[model samples]
Target: MTLFRQIYSLLFSLFLLVVASLGYVQFTETQSFLTKQMESDLNNASTSLGLMLTPALEAGDTVAAETLVNVIFEGGYYNNIKLIWMVDGKQQEWNNPIKIDDVPQWFINLNLFKTIKKESTITSGWLQLAQLEITAHPGFGYHELWRIMSNTLIVFSLLFLVAIFTARLGLTWILKPLNALSEHAKKIAARQFGPDMPLPSTTELKDLVTAFNSMSAQLKHLFQSLDEEVGSLRKKNLTDPASGLPNRQYVVSRLNGWLSEPSSGALFLAKLDWLEEVHSKYGYQVRDETIRLLAEKLVQQLNEITPSVIARIAAFEFAFLVTDVEHDQISKYLQTLIRTINQEISKAGCKPNENFAIGVAERVGQMKVSDILAQADNALQKALKDNKTFHWFETTEQQIFTREQWRDNLSHAISNKKFKFRWQPIQFCNGDGVTQRELYCQLELGDKLTHAGQFMPYIELLSLGSLLDKCLIETVYEQKLLERNYEPLAINLTHQSLSDSQFHQWLNHFLRNAPQVERMCFEIPEAGVYSDLESCTRLCNIIRDNGAKFGIDHFGRQFGSMSYLQGLRPSYVKLDQSFAYYDEASHNSELCRAIINVAKGLDIQVIVTGIQEKAQLERFNELKTDAYQGFIAPPENIE
Candidate 1:
C-alpha cells in the first residue's frame, strides 16, 4: 500500500476506537442513572402507600387496604406490592409480571438494569401497623438505556464518516508533492531531465525535493557536457575548419565503407590549379577566400543533384562521393558541377576553365579503396595534361539489369517471397557468447542468392523498400525463425518502412500475435533516422509498445547531430564499419572513442562492426564497446 493509504487506515482505526469508547461510556452512565432513579421512585412510593394503608389496617379495614394496594399495583411502576399484618403475620400480595414490548429482546437480554425492591413500615401517629414491600420494574430502565445508546451510535457514526473524509483530503494534499517527486524520478531514470519539482510545505518533504532537483540538474549537465564533448571531437577531427566541409579522413572512411559492400558509386576529384598563383599574387587571405567560396558553390550545386559527401582533401583539391545516381547521368552531373565551380570562381576575377580540372572514377562492384583513388587520380592527371575541363574514367563492368528489368525481377521476387536469411552473431566483448544475431537478407534470383548490398539500391530506387520489409518480416514470423532460441533477431528497417503508416499498422498487428515478439529488434540506419526523424520516433514507440527493441545501424555514418539520440533512444547502436579500418592512434579511433563514450553515458550499448581480424578486434576491444560483429565470426546460413 502507499504511504497515504497506510496513514489513512491508521487514522481511521483510531477514530473508530474513540467513537466506540465514547458510545460505550455514554450507554453505561445512562444505564446507571436510570437504575438509581427507578429505585428512588420505588422507595418513595412504598413509603406513601404504607402510610395510607396504616390507617386502614389499624381500623381493621383489610378490605380498604387491599383496594389501595390493588390501585398502586395497577399503576405499573412496581412489579409486586405486599402488605402483611403484624399481629397474625397474614400477608396480602399483588404481583405484576414484567412485559417490555417497546424494547427489542436482544437489548433486554443484556440485562443492563437490575430489579430494585424497597421496604417500609406503615405507622399511624408513630405506631407501626403493617410492613409494605414494593419491587420496581427494570423494563423502563432497559428501554431508556437502549434509546440513548442508539442515538449516541447514530451521532458518532456521522462524526466518524466526516472525520474519515477530512483525513483523506488532508492526506492527498500533503502527499501531492511526493507524487510529483516520483514522476520526476521516473523522468530522470529515462534520461529525460526536465525541471525541478516544486517544494512542499512540509520541511522534510521540501528538503527531499531540493535534493532530488539538485541531482537531476547535475545529471542533465553531465549528459549535455558529454554530448558537447563528442560534438567537439567530431568537429576537431573529421571536419575541415576552412570551408566547413568534411576533412579527407572522413570522406575516405565513408568511401571505404561503401567499397566494403557490393555497392556502386563514383568519386570525383577537383583541383584548383590557380590557388598557388592566387596565394603568391593576392596573398593567403584571398586564396583561402577563393577556396571557401568554391566549396559553398559546390555544396549548393550538389544539393540539387543527390545526397553526396564533399570533402577538402588538400589545399587546392576537393573530393566528392556520389551514390544512387545512374551511370549514364554521371557525365552530365559532373559537367554541370564543373561549370558551376568555374562560374563561381570567375566572380573572384579568376578566368573560368583556365586552371580548374575534375576527374571521375566509376564504381561498379566491390572494389578496393586504393584502386578507386588511383583511378580517379590518373583521370585528374589526364584532365590537366590534355588541358580538358574534366575527364571520366568509366569502369568496364556495368549494372546487371535495366530499370524495367529490375522492377520486374524485384516485383516477382517479393511476390514469390524468394528471400533467404543469414544470421551474424554479435559476440560480447568478454567473449562470453552471442548476445544477438543480426539478420542479413538475400534475394533469390534464378538458382543464386544475391546479397542485399547488390539489390537494396534498386529496391530503394523503386520505392519498394516498405514492401520488401513487410515480406522479410512476414517470412521470418511465419517460418518461426524466432523460435530457435531466446536470443533476439535484429532486422534493419528502411526509411520507407518507418515512414509508412500502413507498415506500422501491419507490424503492430503482426507483433501482437507473434510468439517471442520481445526477441525482435528492428534497426534503422543513421541516415534513415535523420531523413524522417518524426516517423522514426513513432515507429520506435510502436515497436517498444509491442515489447520489442529498436536499434540504429550505420551509426556515425552521417555528420548530423547526435542530439536525436537523446529523444530517439534506441536499445543499441552499431558503429559504422569504416571505424574498423583505422588503427588505435588514428584520429578516427579517437572519434570512435568519443562516440562510444557519449553513447555509453546515456546507457546505450555500442557495437563495432567489420572487425575482420584478431588485431582489429583487440584494437576495438580497448575502446570498451559492448560487442563486435564481423568476419571474426562470419555470418552463418540459417537452416
Candidate 2:
C-alpha cells in the first residue's frame, strides 16, 4: 500500500528467485554425483565379494560364502555390499544390509524416498549361472538414495560447523566496541558523561575509544569553566544566614574532627529565652542578630577561657566545649564564670532584662564526643525548659560504661563497612507522572537501623563525614545503580565535603568510572542552604559540574528571602517534615500558598515528603504539588 511495501515486496521476490535457481542447480548436479559415487562403490564391492566367493565355491563351502557376506557387512566401510540368491525369480537370501551411521536424519529420510534401478549378469566358471539385477526393492528404493544423501551431508557438515564456530569467536571480538559505544550514547542521553569502556582488539574499536575519550574530556572542560559558587573559603560559614551565629553544624564538625580531645574541661551550654519574643516582635533576622551578638559575646568570653570551642547549636541555643578546668573546683568555679558571661551578654543586648538560661555538663573517664556532649545537652534541655540559670548532668560510672559500648559499635560499623543506604523518594512535577526514589545513606545495624540524624554528630566528631559520604555515593553506584539497577538515588552533602578540594576531585574522578553519577541527585539540606548559604551554593555548582543534579532536602522553612537561589537553581526541592505535614483541610495558609507559588515561579518543582497517610496524599494532590514521598508509596517497589 506504500513505497516501503513495494520495495520490500520486490526484494523478497528477488531473494526467493535466487534461492530457487540455486536449489535447482544443486538438485540437478547432486543426483548424478551421488549416483556415480554409489554405483562405483557398489560395483567394486560386488566384484571383490565375487573374487572371495569363487574361492569358497571352488572349495564347495556354503558356510564360507555366508561367512564372507558376514565379514563384508561387518567391515561397514562401504555404504553397501549385499549378496542375494535368486530363487524362482524372488529374493531368497541377502547379506550385508547397508546403513551409514553418523549422518543426519533429514538426509536419511530424503534418500529413503528415492532410488536407482539397474541390473547385472552374474557368472560362475566363465558361464552365466544367473541374471542378477541390483535394482532396489520398491519400498527400499529410498534407502539406496538415503545412502547417497548421507555421503553428501557428511562432506558439508564439517565445513558448516567450522564456519559457525569461527563466526561466533569473531562476533565476540567485534561486539566489545559496539557495546561501549552504546553505553556512551546512553550516558549522553541521560545528560551525563562517563568513561569509555575498554577498547576492542580491532582497529575500528581503537578509533572509537579515541573518539569517546575526546568527547569526555570536552565535557569536563565545559563543566569546570561554568562553576562560580566556590567564591572563597577564608570566611567559610563565618556568618550563619539564619541566626548569624557561626552555624553549629560547621563549628561542631570542625571541633569533633580536628579540635576536641582528652583534657580537663568545663563546657557550658546555654539556651536563650528571649529569642521567640524578639523574633515575634521584629523578625527571624532581628532575633538572629540578637543571637549573633550573643554568639560574639560567648566567643569573646571563651577567649578568656582561651583555646576553648564555642558554637551556636540551634535557633536560640549555644554550647561551649571548654577545657582547662580543675575537676574538684568545677561546680563552684564554672557557675561563677557562667554568671559573669551572662552578666556581660545581658548588659549589651536589646530587650530589658532578657535573662539567659544556662546548663553545665562534664565528661569523665576517656570522654567520647557524643557522650560528653549528651551530658551537656540533657542538662541544657532541662534548665532551658524551666528557664533555670544553671544545671548539670554529672556523669555516673554506669553512664560512662554505656557510652563506651556505643563508641565500640559505632567504630566497628565504620571499620568493617557495615552500613547501608535507603532512598527517600523525591517526587518531581515534571508532569510526566514518573516518580523515582533517591537513596540516602543510613546504617543498617542488625535488627535496628539508624539514620544520620540519629548518629551523624558522632561521625562528624570522628571526622569521618567525608569518608562516610564517599562510601555512600560509591556503594549506591555499585549496589543500587549497577548491581541492583535502580533508576536513580538521592545522596546528601556536607559543608566540610564541599570545601575539601581533594575529596571533591576524588568524587569527580569516581563519577567518570561509569554508572556512578549518572542518576545521582546530590541533596543539600534546606536548612544548610539557609544557614551556610555560600557553601550550599558552591556545593550545587560543584555537583552540577560533576554531571549531577542538585535537590534541596528538607526544602522549606527557608528560600523565603534568598535571591542567590534564583540564579543557581537546583533541579528539585523536597518539602521539610513540617511543611510536608502541613494542615490541609478545606483551606490553605497564605504562607503555605506563598511557598508553593515562589518555588513554582523559580521553575523549581516541589516534593511533599513524610506523607504517611491517604489524607496527606489527597491534600498534596489538592495543592497540585509536583510529587509526594512517604509510606503511601513504599520506596523498594519504585527502585
Candidate 3:
C-alpha cells in the first residue's frame, strides 16, 4: 500500500476504536443515572403510599388500601405495586404485574433499563400495621439510553469522515514534491536537464529534494566536462594547430573517401608563393601568423558559398574540396580566393607578392588518385610558367537552360507546390524492423523531376528555405503516413529553416495539433549544424518537447569535436557514406571508430547510409552498426 493509504487506514481504525469506546462509556453512564433516578422516584411513591395506607390498615379498612394500590398501578409508571396486611393471624395481599407495551422487546432485552423497587411501612400513630411496595418500569430509561447512543454514533461518524478527508489532503500535500522529483529523475535518465522541484514542508522530504537537485547539477556538469574532453581529443587528432584547419592527413583521408564513388566535386590546390618572401623579410613568426589569418579568411569566404572542407596539406600548400560544383562556380570560387588573399596581404602592410596561385581540377567520371593529382600539378606548372593567376582542368557538359530560366522554373515549382515526396524505409540491421523512413523530396519542373541538390541551391538563394520546410510538413501531413503505421517519418531541415523564428513557431503549433507528431523526426545535416548550433539545439529541444525526434545526418564528415552532442542529444547519428569506406585508409577507419566510440559512450544510435554492397554491409555488421539504408533496402516510391 502507498504511504498515504497505510497512514489513513491506521488513523481511521484508531478513530473507530475511540468512537466505540466513548459510545459504550456514555451508554453505561446514562443507564446507571436513569436507574438511580427511577429508584428515587419509586422510593418517594412508596413513602407517600405508605402514609396513605396507614390509617386504613390501622382502622382495618381493606377497601381504602386496595383503592390506593389500584390508583398507583393504573398510572402505568410502575411495573408492580403491592400492599400486604395481617388480619386474625392471616395475610392479605394485592399485587400488580408489569404489562407495559410501548418499548421494544429487544430494547428491554438489551438491559438498557434496570427495574427499581422500594418498600415502606404503613404506621398509625406508633403502630406498624402493614407494608407497601412500589417498583418502577424502565421504559423511560430505555428510550433515553437509545437516544444518547444514536446521537453519539451520528456525531462520531461525521468526525470520522472529516478526519479522513483532512488526512487525504495532508498526505497529498506532503508527497507533492516527491512526484516532481520522480519526473526530474526520468528527465535526467533521458539526458535532459529539467528544472529543480520546489522544496516540501516536511523536513525529511525537504532534505531528499535538496539532495536530488544537487545530484542533478553535478551530473550535468560531469557530462559537459566529458563532452569538452572528447571535443578536444577530436580537434587534436584531425586539426593543424598552426592554421586551426584540418591537417594534411585528415584532408587526404577525406579526399580518398569522396573519390570512392561517382561524385562530382572539385579539388583545388592553392600554393602560397609569398611564404618564402615573407619568411625572408618579416621572419617565420609573421609568415606563420599570416598563414593562419589567411586560413581564417578563406574559411569565412568559401564556407558562405557552400559547406566546403579547407585543410592545410603542407607548410606552404592548402587544399579544399566542394562537392557537386559546376565548372563556372569553381572558377568564380578560385578567383575570389586569390582576391581575398591579396587583399589580406596588402591590409597587413606586407609587400603583396602575387599571394597565391591555384590549380583547380574537377572529376567527371571514375578516375585514379594519381591521375587527378598529376592533372592538378600540371595545371599548377602551367600557371607558374605562363605567370597566370590560375589554371583549371575542365570537362564537357551540356546546358539546356540559362541561370535566369532555371531560377524562374524553380520559383514556379515552389509556388505551385510541384514537389513529390518519396519515403524509403531504413531497415534495421538488428532486425527490429523499420522504425524510421527517409523522406526524399523532388521538385517537378515541367516534364523533368529534379532532386534536392539540383534545386536546393536556387531555393536557398531565394530565401525560401522556411517555406520549403513548411510545405514539406504540410505535404507529409496530407499524405497521412501515420494512419497506416506510427513509425517516425524523418524530414530533412536546412540551416535556414532551423534558424528561422517564424518557422519554429509554425512548426511548434503545427506539431501540437498534428496527430502523429510523436512519430516525426527532423534531420539536420552535419555540415549545416556547425553554423547555428545554439538555434538548432533550441529547435531540437522544442521538437522533443512535442514528442518528436531529432538527429544529425551525414555525420563523421566534420573534423570538429562532437561537443554538440552533449546538448542536442540527438536520437541517432547517421554516419556519412564515407565513414563506411573501411578500405580507404587506416585514418578513415580510425576516424569512424572514434565517432562510433563517442556516440556509443553517450548511448546514441549509429546508422550507416549509402550501403551499395553486401561486403560493406557485412563489414558494418562486424563493426555493429545500428541500422543501414540505401540500395540494400532499395528506394521505394510512395503513391
Candidate 2 clash pair list: 111-142, 111-146, 112-142, 438-490, 439-490
Clashing pairs in 1: none
Candidate 1 structure quality by residue, lDDT tens digits, 353-388: 888789999886667889899999999999999999
Tell me the TM-score of each prediction against the true structure: 0.85, 0.42, 0.74
> TM-score-based ranking, best first?
1, 3, 2
Q: Give the TM-score of candidate 3.
A: 0.74
Off by over 4 Å in 3: 1-184, 192-226, 252-267, 280-285, 301-307, 322-335, 347-355, 361-382, 392-395, 398-408, 484-486, 526-530, 559-566, 582-585, 588-591, 619-624
lDDT of 3 by residue, 330-411 (tens): 6677877777878776866655547567788777557666777777777777777777768887557555356677678766
**Weakest lDDT window of 10 consecutive positions for candidate 2:** 226-235
lDDT of 2 by residue, 481-556 (tens): 5345444666777645756667777877777665556577777766556556665666667777878788876654
**How many residue pairs clash (N, CA or C atoms closer than 3 angstroms) in each of the candidate models, in the order given?**
0, 5, 0
lDDT of all predictions:
0.84, 0.57, 0.75
Q: Pick by TM-score: which candidate is best?
A: 1
